[model samples]
Target chain A: MLPLIHRFIDQAADQNPHHPAFIFQERSLSYGDLVLQANRLANVLIDLGVRPLDRVGIYLTKSMEIPVAIYGILKAGAAYVPIDPSAPLDRVDYMIRDCGITHLVSSPVRKRALHQLLERDTGLKAIVGVDRELLETDPLTCLSWEEVLQADSEDPPVKVTDQDLAYIMYTSGSTGHPKGMMHTHASGASYAHYSAMTYGVGPADRLGNHSHLHFDMSTFEFLTGPSRGATTIIIPNEAMLFPTRLADLVQNEKLTFWYSVPLALIQMLALEDIGNRDWSSLRWILFGGEPFPPKYLRLLMDMLPGARFSNVYGPAEVNQCTYFHVTRESVQGDQPVPLGRVWEGAESRILNGEGQPVRPGEPGELLIRSSTMMQGYWGKPDLTEKSIHIEEPLPGFTKRFYRTGDLVSIDEKGLLAFHGRKDRQVKIRGYRIELDELENIASAFDEVQEAAVVVAEQAGGDKELVAVLLLKEGRNLDSAEARKRFADHLSAYAVPKRIYFPATLPRTSSGKIDRRQLAQEYAETA
Target chain B: MEITKMPDKSQIESEIQTHFQGEGIELERDEDLFSSGQVDSMALMQAVAHLEATYGLKIPPGDLVPENFRTVEVMADYVIQRR
Candidate 1:
């Protein structure tokens, strides 16, 4: 059986107790110290009655405490559900209740928000505040960070198996509510093993953690580093906004492995003169989440002559299934970078509408079969059945394949190139956004009789969400008020940039909302 | 190289509006472009490239903070100061 992810940390700590494990905000924690903290937090979790496979919500920002909470929850034999602390209160409440989360680890700064969320009568039983003083007025049983740290620093000997869930990452769903992707210890361990081997990450490498806890890329950034005994550097949120500052951090931290969405790298390249910076320590630069423009990719290759680049692709449901190494010859073309070959231990197939594998050079949906594939969406059996299909009965065993909904084609060179999405899903800056989700939220408003959302490509090739709302007869809605209402229901990226109240929304012959017509109309008018 | 006059606030706003072309949404001078979902990471990169080419101002990595590009007014101020 595969060992739990925390076992890697334990092994590293035992071997190199004094080696730096993580560096955050100028503070460094050695492997021994980090594991002790995690062990103590695990004892705290056990004392709170957390059992194996139980879901615990992690609602803290990207900080030193995040790694501790994550490893602690894993050590306690419970699956950690990361709730983006910046998410709306209603969304957070929905996830907490949906996942049946019994314990939550958050910072004290969110005390008011947590209290308000708990008022909704979620299944949350205990709240562990990291660095906030517990008050009598707190709605739930709150434990201070100091108290949790005082627990015995011994590993909790919970009977955790490889099949046990390690984490549940929630992503945007087409049906308005976010769906939690369930990943097991086996799947996560496979990813860690393959990733460490593919990227050549080792103890000498300093891996940069740029992605948020809620994002799938963070799995590779956080877990693979520990798996290889590498030092993980958590880039502060504020540093991300300033490309120059982020570059300085990379230089100062001596990051050897850097991974993030292509958008962030593009921003850094545009704002910073990386050609002049000391990037000798930067070895592997990995990007995914969206397609990178060829021009920018070429420029990036030219700028970083010493670094090797890889275009990694996969959904949250399957972590890092395929990777395309950017070669000097590959970057010469005007075409977008190829999705490349499937990663080791993962199977891929391009099937047409009839579910048969398509011929080479024919566009079809990509299906993935791998140990790293998510077990299923949490409490969403119907969605799970629809998204994952079991192959027809074979002699030995049936194979389950996940329909990725991504349209791709294998070129003559045997490289898979992305065409487009087969569904209404769109990615904006590495965030998987479902257009119907925005439409559903808009339709929920009282004044909105009908709503349609479309992705509009700006002059700079950036996709922006545009909403067309048809109000009920004799009723009106203010755009500002609508935007304010959207903030309460969705994340900032999900909010449409422009809201239009048209007299009637165009429909197709089948009476479905015609998004193409709406897009053309909006474009013509603008 | 000859020094040229820096663009005004309205000109920069006009250029940004033309670049983004948000159908009918009017951007305020002090509006937070990022939080408002108007300026994403890619859009910000495009805006930086456009500003450099249009205004002939070298926007170093240090000048790419929120304070410099949070709004057209601030962006124009940054350009004028650099010029």
Candidate 2:
């Protein structure tokens, strides 16, 4: 019964009506104005047959429309499924179908791609774009975002309970096919409250939106910022790849808070003659999504001497349950930055392979229990039961906890430090990757008989993907041709950096490819 | 393109070598720096900063990919061309 996000919007509308909630490109929306627009859109959805518990997929980018769609969905008593506009068509299509989406809210420019996906999958019943042209275009019942907001904003708000489904997020699908992780109103609100309180986010703060809505980290910037009447600035997708441009945006926008992957900070620190910008306003810099290199900590502390840094750690299943405060003392120490203690209302444990609790300093699977934990994997009861569990054996605690596939260690001070993924999952630039997804696609290539893709840490600690294949005996495929084939199926990130046409890949007696041997062989050679 | 006296290729290569300290890249001017694992993205930035500070030229953002930073010779030529 928390109604966290909604309560903030309503409060802002009444208390800080003129304060900016979002500042995009050249436009800004006051708190009252944003809530009013969201209310209008909610009325539109209700008019279009949306009901309690129905799913509405946001097929948009990190634009102003995103928050509007989110609040509108909530106001209509429906759950939201946010699909990253930049995600591969297959990933988006898979998520929409998996969530049983009946409506999609996308941008006008993104309509063609959404149409292509909808053509193959009949689950998406309506595709609404974000403008007047989209509204005018009557091609098979399409409506623009403006058309939807044309409804009266004064309609009595629908009754929504805290126990109701608020959103269904797809895990980056690092282990396999993306599974929908369901959440309730209370769970989503818990994180929004915790993030704002921890960072002291308020109207004076301006948060950066570089992450896609699909990633759980976006929950902190996109939700908490706007909810507090603060300005949330969207970092252009292309600008993120170019450090200078990203720096310019941050400087021009005067961003006060930024949360992104460690890889991005590495890129920023690498820029040539990267002049110290007027970052005096930057109060906090949060990094997560994977283990950050010690080098990053050294560089950032040297560069931004004044800003406070914190390393956030958690899985998408339970968004941001722990944070390690990065003070001047921790920076001067020899140890790698710890992921730190559990956040409020969160508990964690390190368990051995047999599900027994491990001693301190020993690496084991990390388990977490929190209010923000996902309701369950949507439409998969067996999966829900397998992934989430009740206490079977523990000396002191008897409660349910979510079993994270990540390997971690608990320090003597009870701080949790992440080691690596226990499963075949790997994180590249904060994006969870399922190696099986790459292998399954690579196996589909015409000239490949068997493809085993292994990731290796090169010198100075850079992870590179190397594919070792046992091709058809007489067939020879050059690296260029093999890479081209891989590009056709997988995204640029999933493509292996180097392709090795080995005579035969080493296999264990159990008839499984020995990844350890491949890594060792490639580590020295790559 | 702004032109400055091209420093001895050997001197530029020496600077690149010193910056890469323990990194395993041959100190040849013509050898591919990126593909041979001699310089990674971070090392490339270090090299770029050195060239910018020493040679008085600003490297554009678009030209900062691995292809352009392939070799000491290529980087020197690019700096000369862009200057």
Candidate 3:
């Protein structure tokens, strides 16, 4: 059987050879052209001694090179590691060394960074930069993107078993190190196939590539788009943060499909001139990086009367496990929006803290079992075991299930509804937050004598972390000064929503600040 | 407090209603904005900015949270509440 991603690209090239497969800034690559380029890239990799199962890191931003690099890696029968360029420098070094990556195909800018980093750790085989001149001099030295594509071979990679790893993606590490989750060809294919069917992707669809490749939401855009012969348009970087640019692309390119976190959708809805933008071309909007506000759902429906909005539920470990179809009737009713039905080849259930299945309407942890389940964290076997567990006395218990950590419930209709996270890990604008990280920063503040961070529920059921601090004996700092200090050490989102100066922290008899009590106070005052 | 009708009150109420129409409960001019739990801090930002731009008014950055946007009525009052 053909590998899942290749099967789609091959079919698309054969059926619609002249159709535009990818549209970057001033360049448009047709299905046939993309195939040829990927084939040449595969030939270059083979000549450089890259073999089946060898991991190749693609370190770059969202660009034309990303798609070519993905296709080339798979074409060489090698799995790819999509390194986020914007991640902290230490993270980039850790992923390269941890994955045992041999070659990194990246842009010239990244090549420079790699050069500086690899000098400190020279075990890397090569730093392949995207320049024609760079590729000619050395099989072991840095090669350019053009040099790799100059080969004439049209042959595809040799077939491999379904269980062979396809890609390795790293997510936020709870244990002080980023964890790389490995996915096999078949499992990763499951995500591409299910997304195509679920989102109704086809030749006529124009899909927007919005999410960074590091994020799972971009999988469908980069993987399924080419396989389905749909046109995948990469939104320019500056356009990502602004809604006007997205509106322009949708109306200009006639983009029919969109996938991003709900926060992006809300930003689009808040546009004062949103009414002027013609988003009629958008047919499907699949969103879920975090729990979306139901209010944003209604605003979207009112704005785009024809778009089919869906709530996608899944963690990075399992690509996409469930979806809730957005309907007007559901919005009018009092019930919360469902995360929808389980996608193809997936099974899901809500389990209580004790691991037993919860009764319908009872909140519990959401668990997923599916073909798309990751192999495991790249190196941390202990964490892998804890996250992927087996239920005793159950057959196929060895088959792993991923714990999503999200508290949820199942309705009578079997639709999943999100409640909250069981841990202090809150999603701030789609980026995962470990409250402990904030606490670490708060404790580091020189002026702060003591601190506690708690998620407070605000109006419309949204949660925000507010930091309550007790100053040192004689020193007092205002909220502005404390926030500035937090910004220096953490990302802006990690900074608490509000900083409160309390005369004395409310503590339990044991002397631990009563965080629960603080939350109650915020709820009352908020 | 009862709100006096302002030129921007109708525009603010209309936008808030449209902004929050399908998400959940509808909004009235005198509804508790967000601090009192009528809307949310996250969703309220959208409503605040909508009113500011639609009417050419600016809500200070220091006054960003729900305390400032507690009600469509308070917001309407804020049109005059500003220093």
Q: Which candidate is the best by TM-score?
A: 1
Ranked by DockQ from best down, the candidates are 1, 2, 3
Q: Which candidate's DockQ is highest?
A: 1
Across residues A341-428, which tens digit of lDDT does each residue of candidate 3 receive?
8777797767898889999889999888898789888888887888876765576546567888889888788888789888767777
Selected candidate, larger TM-score, 1 vs 2: 1
Model 1: CAPRI class: incorrect
lDDT (Cα, 0-100) at B30 in candidate 2: 66
Predicted candidate 1 versus true structure: per-residue lDDT over A1-526, tens digit per residue: 5578889889899889999999998799999999999999899989989999999999876678888998999999999999876567788889988999989988765655665676677877788864334444344577888888899998989998889999999999898889999999998988898888888889999999998889899998678899988999988765666677787788888899889988778877876367667778889999999888888988877777899999999888989788889998887878788999888879888999998989999999999999888999999999999999777567878899899999999877778989999899999778899988888899999999889999876556567788999999999898867876776767666778778998878889999989998887765332
Candidate with top lDDT is 1
The TM-score of candidate 2 is: 0.82
Each candidate's number of clashing pairs is: 0, 1, 13
Model 2 error, position A282 (Å): 0.6
Clashing residue pairs in candidate 1, if any? none
The TM-score of the first chain in every model comes to 0.97, 0.91, 0.86
TM-score of chain A of 2: 0.91
